[model samples]
Target: MIKALFKKEFIDTIRDKRSVVAALFGALFTPLLFAVMMTFNIEKARSVDDVYIEINNADMAPQIVELLDRESIFHAELPSTGKKFELNGETHTHSKISLTFSDDFESQLSSGLPANILINADYSDQERSSQIRRVKRVLENYEGAVLNMRLVARGISPLVIDVVDLEEQDTSTPGSKSAIILGMLGVFILFSVFVSSTNVAIDCSAGERERNSLELLLMQPVSTFDVVASKTINTGLFGLFAGTLSIALTAVVIPFIPLHKIGMAFNFDLEVAVKMWFIILPLAFFAAAFQLVTTFHAKSFKEAQTYIQYSIMLPLIVPMALEFSKYKHAALDYLPIVAQQQAISKLIRGELTDFTPVIGGMIVTMLFSYGLVLFTSKSLKSEKVVLGL
Candidate 1:
């Protein structure tokens, strides 16, 4: 019966240490690595709230210095051990940025005239750009305060300078915002499906044929369809288990990403996680089926592995490429990897209003898997393939 074939293949796969390691590595290590990179990006992308700037003429503008301190910008002393940087083919140590107030800065302010604060630095250096911007914003605020005092003393409303009223309303939620940067989580989860089943798929197809076991199996009165179905079922389970674990691990990891610091929220609650698991269900089998087909076309385990390693990259690359291009279409919504990505993103953003497309896409994916299953079954009946010629 098909049950005996399935049991035999499943046990063989489980007993292979390589398959177990592939499953654990794909499911366990990937989500953790992704989280670590995301955390690094969060720190890099956010503006520095507290920064250090050097002041050349501290006595000339005490008010400016006070305002800078209030804004968490402090004067920095040059360090004894120099940290160096490279720009425009030049090697340099130290930020070397300083603010020099005009000699008559205090007098100009008292007489209601323009005061100059010259910023001195190598503007070409990219690493110091954020520090420069933060210091400039605080100084600009101090200028606005002085202008307001001037207007009050002259018996004029400070509102006269602001002739146009600019109002801004942000309607973006944290989940929607998180969907922008963290969308790759879905891609990684789907990629795991392709990765986890690779060793098992190769073992069931090319490895068996290479070991002269395929000819023996065909010698039985078993249907080739039964053999193909059992192999697919066995490999698909490994992919599915890995995919499911990927989703759960991603859900656990995303909450600790400091999304709130960047004004983004990702509510990967039980409902959304469950929905994501369901969305990837058909994809698991499709990935396994795809891997098996790729492997079965090759004559040996090494050739199959070479083909499989490249084949697995399609699931990872296609989704991310489409996403980075910011392209969307009504037709692409039913495509396999793209469909899962969109559905998962929508679920994370709490914008998945209709289940019809999700269900339709799932049906389409299963049909594709079945088509591969049929092709693989027919391949087994060939003399050249069975003999690994």
Candidate 2:
């Protein structure tokens, strides 16, 4: 009997063209969009390797020019009008970095006076700003070397000026370093479950009522628990399909994103996919039951859509807020969506060994889902809900 009810609900849901299209689109679009954006950013990062700057008085600082050349910064002739042009089938804009050395720079250095080297660049341009900082560091090194030579000639030890030796050692792994990007990926993965179940939940509830068939189903010999359980199961299956599809697509697309270019290593391998699936599957049930309860309360199909749209924000906003918060409480890992996000993030960073929090959250999520299904079943027996009063 339960199998027949599930089959009936499942067939009806798949036959609805709108629900099928919505499910497929929600499952596929986010991963594809993420891939395209990451690919574009990687290409832009690679383009910074060959930086071209303009030097106004090359003769004044031959040694400095040599330093710039070794640093991969070459002088280029650019238009004085500052107009955009095309190069190699791509539109190009010249960076506004100009170097000008004073004519008496050598004399000033010889006399132990300050030598003037003017760096002109648009500070507002992010790419140009990075190049400008590189240029400034190179010039400072040259100045320090010349000053040390002058100290040696004067019978003074160069170590007289040496004080503190500063060094940097970064211990972040590629996975940990990509926290921001991975956090966003987790959000999209979790959101797919909600999106996949949305149309089906609404259809089985308010949509059935609008079609004037919900009353007929309610009058059947089946218990209210059976009816609600069958609908929730159907919705959950849709959510699970969408969530799994998103993970598969993400695994396929992540490898081609050039994340290594930015020192961000994200491996959506089979193990990670399997872990993510476990983390997200219970959320699918929760999403289905929650949406079922919410939609069952709405007076009409359009009104149900409005309620579900607002409810969707809770999942997106809550997890993101927890992921980015400065003050993280350890108890957050025991919460539903928050726990799942943290687990996925740790999995991405390869730091997750203990599954206690994840399992705990899944159990809590399932219990909550069961409670919502019971509430929805009880609502089905109410006259106001059945008659849309």
Candidate 3:
């Protein structure tokens, strides 16, 4: 009897056009969006290898110009023009690095006196900052040579000018860089599972109730538990399949994305994939169970759909917020989508899995699924839900 009900539920779900389209697009769209966006960003980063700089201080500093040329930093002579930045139709000029030399520049250096030169550029432009750093390094080297030449001319030691040397220590690991994206990808994957399961679960539970079919099925010799179990199992199965396909697409596209530019590496291990899928499995049941509970109370198929659609927003927004804020969400081990988000994100970052959370989440999800099944089954025995009252 249970077998017959399960088979029937599976068939009916597969035949629904709306469910099929929703599942198909739900599985396919995320990968397409992520792939295209990453590709565009990568191409844009690769486009501007050669940058243009206009220099105004040609007469004041032969050493500065010579230093810039020797380093292959190309610049064109613009009209004693100060550096102007135009972004979004707004222009700002910084003449800080723009050299306007004093008339007795050579005399000052010869007399061991400091000569002023102008420097100008926006410190805010990141790409321009990189260029400025290179230019600054060259200027520092030129200053060192001039300082040494002056010291020798004065019969003083150049070593007296030496001071402190700065050193940087970078302690960040590969995992930290991958952590942000790991969370985002996990959210996408878990949301895929939730979305793919929603249609089938809602249609099977609420659509059947609205069509007056659930009452007939309940009146039959089969136990209400079997009816509920079959619904949960079938929806979970379909959701798993759709989710697996979407995950596979992500796995394929990650390696192709140039995440390195943003300091992320898209490396996936088979062991990690298996663990992530395991973590995802219970969420599938949770989604199906939640959908069933919501749908059983909905008065119509459209009403059930509206509820399910809104339900999807919770998974989308919360996990994304956590990712952006870099909040460590350990307490979510028992929360449905939150649990899945945390676990799968850890898996992506190659973190050690705590069986406690994974098992605890599975137990919480299963209990919730079974409790929902019990409620729905009891509700199916009522005229209220079955008759859409």
Candidate 4:
């Protein structure tokens, strides 16, 4: 009897041209978008050339120019000959630089007077900041080396000028390397969940209602619970398939990424990939169950679809809001998507696999799925939800 019900639901879904097309397009569209975005980001970062700086100084300017050249931080270009500076040009004023020396630069230094150098840069260009900082550091080095030479000439030990030196150590894990990508992964999961499950859920509930076929199925020998359960299983199966495809496509594409060039990159683990498959299966079940409950009470396929679309968006909005609000994930060892994301992130970076979260997420997902199915079955007994009220 259960097999018959499953077969009927599958056949109904297949016959619905709209549902089939939605799933196919959603599945193909998502991977292509991910690939294109990743490729563009990698190439853009890898291709930026070193910046160029122009200096106009009389005294000690040669020393500063030598400092800039030694670091290879920026190339020194001659003054522009054109009447006007064109920042829009592909090569020339793409950026502007100015370095000026004091009128009494060498005299001030000889008399123990404070000396100053002026640096002007196009602050509007965001990429120019790092090069600016690098140039500033080289200038500081030149100052320090000169100070040491002066002190030694006066028979003074340079040790008196130094007190404490500090160093910084970055302890962030490689998994946590790209907070943005993890955030992106969270978004991608939410997208796949909604796109994969929306059509199936709407078709099973509202679609059935619209066709007048739901009434005939209800009149049969099967219990209402069985009917609801069968539909939930069918929708979930499709979601699980879509989820698996998304993950598989991610794995295939990640290795091709230029990890070293970009500051952040995704590393794949076979074990994590396997674990994601397991984690997503239960998540798919819960997603389908949740969608069925939201859609079951609607009058027409279109009405049910509208309600389910909102339901699907909840997963996307909530996780993202949590991430943006900087809400540290609770002990996700017992949470669903939180745990799966946490564990998968760790696994990707070749860290210790916390099975506790994986098992906990699975159990929570399944329990919720069962509860949703029960609610859906009970709602079927109400004439309002079943009879188009």
Q: Which stretches in model 2 have alpha-carbon errors above 4 Å?
A: 49-55, 65-99, 109-113, 119-132, 145-161, 323-331
**What is the lDDT for 339 in model 2?**
78
C-alpha lDDT of residue 166 in model 3: 66
lDDT per residue as tens, model 2, 310-384: 766767888767658765877777777777877887887787899999999899888888999999899888999
4 in model 1: Cα distance from truth in Å? Answer: 1.9
Tens-digit lDDT track of model 1 for 1-389: 88999999999999999988998888887799889988998998885455555687889999889888887776765545665544358544555678889899999989989988998877888978877887788888888998999899999999999988999988877667778777777777878888888999999899998888888999999998889888988998998999889888988898788888888887788988899899999988888888888888898999999999987897778777877989988777888877887788778668899998899889888888899999988987888778877
Look at candidate 3 and give me any clashing residue pairs: 96-119, 96-120, 97-119, 97-120, 98-119, 98-120
In candidate 1, which residue pairs clash? Answer: 174-265
Q: After superposition on all CA atoms, what RMSD does each candidate show versus the true structure?
A: 4.0, 3.6, 5.2, 4.6
Top-scoring candidate (TM-score): 1
Per-residue lDDT tens digits for candidate 3, residues 116-224, read 6655667886756777777778778988898898789889998887776668987766567756645667777777887887889888888887777878877778887
Residue pairs clashing in model 2 are none
Whole-model lDDT values for every prediction: 0.84, 0.85, 0.75, 0.73
Q: List candidate 1 segments past 4 Å from native.
A: 46-54, 69-93, 122-130, 320-329
What is candidate 3's CA lDDT for residue 59? Answer: 64
Q: Answer with 2 or 4, whichever has the higher TM-score.
A: 2
lDDT of 4 at 113: 75
